[model samples]
Target: MPQTENQTQVTDRPQATKTAILVIGGAEDKVHGKEILQTFWQCAGGTDAIIGIIPSASREPALIGERYYRIFADMGAKEIKVLDVRDRDGGRDSAYLHYVENCTGIFMTGGDQLRLCGLLADTPLMNLVVERVRAQEIALAGTSAGAAVMGHQMIAGGSSGECPNRALVDLAMGLGIIPEVLVDQHFHNRNRLARLLSAISAHSDLLGVGIDEDTCAMFDSDRNLQVLGRGTVTIVDARDISYTNQNQVHGADPISIHNLKLHVLRYGDRYNLEGHQVIASS
Candidate 1:
């Protein structure tokens, strides 16, 4: 049975039977991002899987022209189709609907998530995606902006490295493929720790994951997270803590944070999300 959005939340799903969700940082292509894509393919059961590419997030749809699709074809995907959800109609095109209905694995290209959500939110196509993922018949993978939308709370930052306060950052409910954890991409490369940390600090109940560029984090059915790629994924936990006068701290305020454990995960490393602890070594 397909899990209703309200019935079994992403975080509360029985780990023994959940599907895998892949979140990739930026720079995806054959030249540099091939490994991320290849790993995703392998996890999705290889060439036999149906793959759908949603390029709707791109600023200019033409930028993701034929070359991108060719790469997936070469990788042996049974079929490949691009969903132009950026349109005013929100990828309501017949071709887009057909592809989403048949795909076993959906890949959201790195681009502007606001644009992607603006076009797809509340649309029939978006509903289908939610349905597919709930059924666990398909895997949802997104890079950059695409990756940002997997969580219930998404980071829509105005500047590259600006840390946001509770109301400063624009956050909207995401597709709900993963819950509790707020994801930020281009971590180390973009120096986004402060922003991510601030987000966690603001919402102490939520977990913060900062994935480095060219890296991928795989969260399996049981909410077990694995990190892959050349770089690292930083997990920031502020679940229990005590703080005072953060707003009053002067030049380089020395704020003390206790009970916060920071874990740097590399390729092949795994962690249990519920327990908020690492399970395997890198």
Candidate 2:
């Protein structure tokens, strides 16, 4: 028997210093202004930042890892290390774990979400990263596929350019860094609003956060999610959804959902994850 309406939520928080998690949509501005990466650099301690890059999600780990390495190096980071772990065994390598332990910031590059999880999930390295982030020992940031893996309930794959339906999206367990939400990257650019809406219709308990390209949903230690970038962040709140036919709907059948709250936020706008309140940009 499955639990439908009463799924137990994970309640865990960092009790130490303030923490920040930057979830960036795909194709961030890396050459020109570099605002998003700059913000991440500042959050991670600016010039004193000891950064670690996880390029495991990418097919060309060396290439992707070096690209970020050059980016951070050019940004005047104190130290930057690329941890290109390809297999489960690499996750346990003491050297990589040592760098992660000492790192002030960790960045996961964009690539294959499923491949990323398949390589690192439940491993000692992944567990350590989660533990450190929760303890406020490190600032975490992920782009694209990396962003998709920030939530406990992740959208692994889905079809776009369609109405909300049961088969519009595929869900998977993510890193659980932010367990109460589901993240979708390259949002509007890929026309994934319906995909996210379909996902929320099924699991109405989780907040569906859809981030547009180059944008970021920056979640602080206090659970205040702030929008930053050139585009908007769409929040789908179904906590008070009056009706949804997800349970009754089968594959590809359109689902009906009512009373769902939608918020489209831009730069400097904030949303409290704990209370589900929106704070408009001044």
Candidate 3:
């Protein structure tokens, strides 16, 4: 059953000063492994942090649940709860709300982003998630489909490697936990350069981040993003890309791409979103 408007009261937890949002492209187990676990350990302040997993995007609930259970366990999270947002009860169950309220960190699993958004959007659960991140200083992280839903505008639906036209692109409102930038996952593997470039061309003010698999870009409270894992995060900026025939194009028409800045960041490399500078070299 679809979620109703009113189910539970929004949480009023006090926010923390230091908060981090980790966005992973995919293949979390293969990409960072022990290091990823270690990062979570350090971010949560200990091995015994209260962690919650939202795997509503996955079609196979048992597989998704087990995958997260093992991942968190390997990361040394003692108290981990997997919230079943797909419950026929309409996502308003008291147990689900309780876990969301108390969790120190919430991780989103990769699958169908649209499914995940459908289950959480406009529900009291989503409101609590936003509140927890702002007020309680909860660390929110997502891999693949999980990563795609962090920004204000998400690529809820799009074709792979295809140059985006107005009709080819499908943008949906996201959780808005991260702002200004649009994120694309499995970037290199999927040859998503054209799609991201097209998105930047359409919205000149927004930044396009194409994250490779097995890698993560962690945005800190100070708006500094640090890259981690084996792969790279490519930042595409077409703010200066001059074009005249944007509206005349139809299917995969070539558009002039100029003044585009591309940055490939690796582990330990930090980029300042506010200043658009590479602070600490990887």
Candidate 4:
């Protein structure tokens, strides 16, 4: 039987001050164990978690949002509500912004990353979300398109399943939740390595994160990254890359880069952004 939205109760307790964000690669296995959603629920606030779901990125907001509402309810969320940030005006409305006060966590559903950012970026809603996250008032989780928008610089559009090419990829400003990093979802299934490699060529200072299907990378305010779920997370480290024709290259041509370090971590693996170390589980 499907759980009703009423199952969640509002909590009056003081909010916890530990900010966290979850970046899911997309197509999470919801039925078998619901591992990702369950983890998100616990991290958000467990029984006291009141999740504010934003479906603005999706073309079919209401129709697509029902799945998450029911899933969160079954997972014991104190309250779950879907928001419609379909336009710039809606994002600025004070009435809609009130949802953030009662929320312990905010979940952004997968869809078109551009649409999500386009409508909310630089708006009051996004400002509030970021403020709450930094204050540790709530945690944020997003899958697929939601995951893509988590970085400071995002891959707006690109060609996949090919050798690295700089011109074919288009980069854009993201919501900037995760600093000094770029996130790409559905990595393994989509064969996005080439594109991600090229993306790093453009922004040598950023770490390129490739997350696999049904997998996730959780980042804490301390900048510690942990891998979870059934799949893996690939890290494209360009910090040590000696050289690249990326800057000089023009048109749709193969990019040449050297000494780009790659790290592939599976479930339970951890990474420290400040220390730039991989803390693998034994």
Candidate 1 residue-wise lDDT, 162-273, digit = tens: 4443333556777666778888898898888766765576566778889988777888877788876677788887877676244554433443455777889876677898
Name the top TM-score candidate: 2
Q: What would the per-residue lDDT of candidate 2 be over residues 1-282, giving only the tens digit for each residue?
A: 111111122122111223689999989888876777877887778899999999999999999999999999999999999988999998898998988888899999999999899999998888999999999888999999999999998999999877999788999989999999999999999999999999888889999999999888999988899877788899999999999989998998888999999999877788999889998765
Candidate 3 local Cα displacement, residue 230, angstroms: 0.6
Judging by lDDT, tell me the better candidate of 1 and 4.
4
Model 2 residue 252 lDDT score? 87
Backbone clashes for every candidate come to: 2, 0, 3, 1
lDDT of 1 at 267: 65
Using Cα atoms with residue i matched to residue i, what is each candidate's TM-score against the true structure? 0.83, 0.93, 0.86, 0.92
Query: Which sequence of candidate numbers ranks them by lDDT, best first?
Result: 2, 4, 3, 1
Instruction: Using TM-score as the measure, name the better of candidate 1 and candidate 3.
Output: 3
Provide the lowest-lDDT 10-residue window in model 1.
9-18
Better of 1 and 2 by TM-score: 2
Runs in model 4 with CA error above 4 Å?
Answer: 1-18
Off by over 4 Å in 2: 1-18
Q: What is the C-alpha lDDT of each candidate?
A: 0.72, 0.87, 0.73, 0.84
Write down the RMSD of candidate 4 (Cα, Å): 6.4
